[model samples]
Target: MTDAPALFLGQSDQPETLLLSRANRHGVVAGATGTGKTVTLQIMAQGFSEAGVPVFCADVKGDLSGICMPGSPNEKLLARAQEMGLALTPKAAPTVFWDLYGQKGHPIHTTVSEVGPVLLARMLNLNEVQEGVLSVVFHVADKEGLLLLDLDDLRSMLAYVGENAERIGREVGNVAPTSIAAIQRSILQLEQQGGAAFFGEPALRLEDMLRTSLDGRGQVNVLDATRLMNSPRLYAAFLLWLLSELFEQLPEVGDPDRPRLVFFFDEAHLLFTDAPDALREKVEQVVRLIRSKGVGVYFVTQNPADIPDSVLAQLGNRIQHALRAYTPSEQKGLKAASQSFRPNPAFDTAEAIQGLGVGEALVSTLDEKGAPRVVGRTKIRPPDSRLGPATDAERAQIMAASPVRGLYDTPVDRESAEEVLAARRGEADQAAADAKLAEARARADAAAAKEAEKAAAAREKEQVRLDREAERARAPARRSNRQTPVEALTKSVLRTAGSTLTRELLRGVLGGLKRR
Candidate 1:
């Protein structure tokens, strides 16, 4: 039992270690502020890395950045090492820094489709109706083969759904415009809080977080959450999304010798704060089921009560720091925390919980057989890495040396729902414009035809008038040239007499010529 390979957490009677094989059962580290919870986290992170198990943790206060740099020996660290009867060596874990905003580390992003509607509804603080509307939006996107890659895509989808609420609602569900508007306002609020940067491409690949360095040490991915902490909902939703992604992407390995990845969720209270019962249940379910995928989820928070009981029950390893019991509620919380631990007959667990000093915690971890050991009042080990924030220069150097340097630094805005809907809207607008133009042209043609017909009618009337005038002038000439019946008879008689006289002259001339 003593020779079993384990993560040396702290020393009670001897070295109290967490069995590496049982690490995927999940754990919790709870303490009030300045109770060395971060250091405990750092030590565990170091152990996991040294064991070649990759770790992902949020750098909530920027302190975890020091894991990138080697630690400096100090009197306090040396005293703790000597007290724990171990030689503490200063070493740094291979670390890769990440930031949601891309300012502090490599930008970590996930597409809207990746985040999905459930977490998004929680992120936007949507009510049931709004949640339903958001779900419908996602459904419509899927049905139309629209890729929702970024915030703009989501915005466009929401607008599209709003514009076609009746039609889409009939297909998906009943989508209320008010619900859509509320979701829209919620998205805008999230954007203002810097949540918009987290949705886009190229999205973070889960394999990147599981990478180990060339030296075989696990890569410690430290997400810079300094700015993200302001939007607690976004922070929670992002972490949940990551967990969901891991659960979905990683194949089940059963009980492996070590976890595929170990996740440290700091400020874990945000995950459950005002979370709906259904979401809480889903989270509890993920925590329970994800272990089968060989992933370990450790929740770091101030109070044990912050975690839902269902989730808290799944955590096998517990390192609880001191809790102050000045007020009644605090006393009640202290009682709850103290009662949660498996009692060690060596000391009063409740008294020990109150009296534990900084760097000391009540440690309990799963045995090699996958059962919780009796809780022990233990002095936690100091981190081999530096205990404070890294300098800007060091962070820059680490980021520059990252294997994924150019991978996610630049964002990609691929053709998504936003562009597609915009094109559709443009086409629709152009069609409307064309139709209007056609209608106007038809009206203009009709008016011109009407004017032409009037002109033609006027011209026909003028031609008729000229023909009548010509006929009238001819009629007067005909009347003036007209003769009486007697005149007509005299003319006829003269024409007959002329004919007879010509004939007689011709006959006389012929007779005279013949006689000569």
Candidate 2:
């Protein structure tokens, strides 16, 4: 047996300890509603923190916030710790509270692009066709280099895509108006459900959740999810996004001495409930591969069957509290839960699961060789932290001392898709107006030119008429019987001929005829 750094889960046939080295392999905590699941999660979270591993978990019932305060164990808890040979030191994990609504703790924010279309569609409860249209919209935004930072940005982009559907459809795919409208309605519904606060600038930084205290203890990032539970999809989507962010950003670390971070997904059924196949496949993929990044994901749910078998198979450590098998479905759940653990000749695993008490559980963890250890019935360890939710004043003090105090408190509204699209619309309107004005000016100029041409023609015609009348008035008057030029010339010729003839008669008639 290796004496590596480990968490002493509880006292069992032997000590039930989870080797820190194999903690990255992932785990699960399953039980009924009041079967000590929350307490188990609390202990595991504080254990990871004390071991210098940062932890992130949702405070579903608001009670998990008590992890930020030191414990004051009663007689029963003290007796349990004493029985386990553990020194119950009253100390709290260094905790930072986070909230999606920015009410109970520091606000958590992420952009629309960060969430992506698949998860965003899931958040909006969109149908397949609507989801496809949303993907197209996101593709257009990305191709255009538009930032979808907030809900308003997404709304504007949706409207823009809808208006230019035919044009954008040719480039990407068909963006049906009905699908767009459906998605728009879904977004509006999401906004009404208080999901709008989660999408904006100053988004969550992974480093903030991965911080270690000045004293070398890991910070427990407690996400207050009391109200978030109302919007179950939003809560699930946000956590999934955070996990994805870690998976993408963190470098591969293989198996280290311990996990760099431990993430607890409480009310985990919400993650898989009504999840589409593509999204379910993605969740399984992330859960399967994220261990190599030195992160451990532990799911806390009411039943083991709440998790898919593919994902369930990846969990190396399992702490199962009591469960009820009244109905066939629940009986099946019980059977499945029991079958997950290696058989214990000491007792039937299924009956053991049902018989477990509030603080008692069946603990099974990976052995030194990375094999499943033989199941053991264990008495769970008492948390060194407080057992319930923190007071408002305590949460306030914690928030004030948080490392990321003012970083994401104020919402940022820089120029994004919304503003850019608005500007585009404004410019388009102005261009249309300018074109109309130009057309009007052209028509008016044509009318003016036609009128000027008609006026010039009228002036020219009047001038010709006046010139003709003046010429007539200025002319000298002639007798009505005045002979023409041809007539006068003929008369002169005749007179000359007559005179010549008279002269010729008197002298020579031949000379007069020659002169004529």
Query: After superposing candidate 2, which stretches have Cα over 4 Å from the reference?
Result: 462-516
**TM-score, candidate number 2:** 0.90
Q: Considering only N, C-alpha and C atoms within 3 Å, which residue pairs clash in candidate 1?
A: none
Alpha carbon deviation, residue 470, candidate 1 (Å):
2.2
| Candidate 2, residue 132: lDDT | 89
lDDT, model 1, position 84: 84
Work out the TM-score per prediction.
Answer: 0.91, 0.90
Off by over 4 Å in 1: 476-516
lDDT of 2 by residue, 1-516 (tens): 578899988999889999999999999999998989999899999999989999999999988999999999999999989998989999989999999899998898999999999999889999999998899888899999999999999999999999998899888888888898898899999999999999997988899899999988899999999999999999898889999999999999999999999999999999999999998999999998999999999999999899999999999999999999999999999999999999999999999998998999999999888999999999999999999889999999999988999999998889999999999999999999999999999999999999999999999999999999999999999779988999999999999999988886876667777899
RMSD in angstroms, all models? 9.7, 5.9
User: Can you write out model 1's per-residue Cα lDDT over 1-516, one digit (the tens) per residue?
Assistant: 556668999988867898878999999999999999999999999999999999999999999999988899699889989998878788889999999999999999889899888999988999888887788888889999999998899999989988888887677678887887898899999899888899999999889999999889899999999999999999998999899999999999999988889999999999999999878988998999999999999999998988988999999999999988899988888888888888898898878988999999999899888888899889998888998999999999988899999999888887889889999999999999999999999999999999999999999999999999998888743456788999999999999999999999999999999999
